[model samples]
Target: MIDVLPPWPLLGAFLLASLLLAVTPGPAVVYLLTRTLAQGRRAGLASVVGVALGNLGNAVGAAIGLAALFAVSSLAFTVVKYAGAAYLVYLGVQALRSAQAVPQQQAQTPPATMKTVFRDGFLVALLNPKTALFFAAFLPQFTSAAHSPLLQSATLGAVFVAVAATTDVFYVLMASLVAGRVRRMGRARLWGRYATAGAFIGLGAYTALSGSRGKA
Candidate 1:
């Protein structure tokens, strides 16, 4: 049996952690699903691409000294992390309050242009400090100080992005399917807003609590 798996158990750790992380609800999924149900699949996919690019940036940061820099500088890391936490909370509060700005069953109206969608996606992911910290914490588990960690961590990050795209795309498709049928129902749209809002709140709370915790 030619040994194939890396001698590092941390690779498996990274994979498991990535899988769990992908399943967790975040702004990426919410943005994708909202765009899909509001605009269309193409727009949603563009958003996914932007998020994947952002994740790629995270991987690059890990490969270079960025993650290490943050790890070493507690003040910098804390600043970014808390800022991210506050942002998530702000999004949650906005979602909860969005009930008043727009009428129900209008999510499908004023479809988002592709350019707007991509720009929104890019900005959302780039400003998201949680994703940065996520890469910082998760990438190191799959590599070691003695080994060349850049390529390995980048590969792991790619895998994570692939999984996230698949997971979130599925969510968009499912939500879009439901949207087509439920758009006629005012109550259904309201439920979706409430659900998305609640997910945001839960994610924000989790991000705030989980700050700076290292797994594996």
Candidate 2:
């Protein structure tokens, strides 16, 4: 409850969300696993760090854009922000309550030095449309109006990058250990959906009860 990143509930929720996303063996995790299986563990680790930096950049951009809106129109931001968060939470809940297919695919990148691997991974992830969209779409739901918007944005970005890197490292380990079953673990996403939905609900409830809206 020290509230280093956001308020305790949001911080906890973000951490849970980050962990769920990271460990779910989604696109990013699958990408890392393929790299490890094809090239080597070192390359996979490099890619992990590189992708993390790229995601950080995306998160920062999204955070800045959203925070600037808050500065310009607190009233509009209030309406849009809550509405968007609610919609996303609804989507997450629906996903949690539904069953979905988890398809597996990986892009091939030739073996290379750690630096090249890192650079390629960085560029690839930085340019990924989903990264930008996801950060802008989801990160603001946890922001605290009590803090400076810029500070909150940066902290969330940093935390997201850190959590992603750590989780990617685990995928790299598993890939090295057993490449054949890496994609087979897609069932993990089912649990991740639950965790993500729970986090969303927790965040929405926290925002409602914390009185941040009244202060804002």
**Taking the tens digit of each residue's C-alpha lDDT, what string does model 1 give over 1-216?**
012224556556766777787888765787677767655678778888877777677667766766676767877666766665566566567766775567764654454478866766665665555566667676666565665677666666777888887887778777777666665666777666666567656656665577353421
Q: Candidate 1 — which residues are off by over 4 angstroms?
A: 1-17, 82-109, 144-147, 186-210, 213-216
**Which residue pairs collide, candidate 1?**
none
Question: What TM-score would every model get versus the actual structure?
Answer: 0.67, 0.59
Model 2: residue 189 alpha-carbon error in angstroms: 29
In terms of lDDT, the poorest run of 10 residues in model 1 is 1-10
Best of the candidates, TM-score: 1
> Across residues 114-137, which tens digit of lDDT does each residue of candidate 2 receive?
887687567546644345556765
Best by lDDT: 1
Model 1 alpha-carbon miss at residue 96, Å: 8.3
List the RMSD of every prediction in angstroms.
4.7, 12.3
Give the whole-model CA lDDT for all candidates, comma-separated: 0.67, 0.62
State in Å the error of residue 47, model 2: 0.6
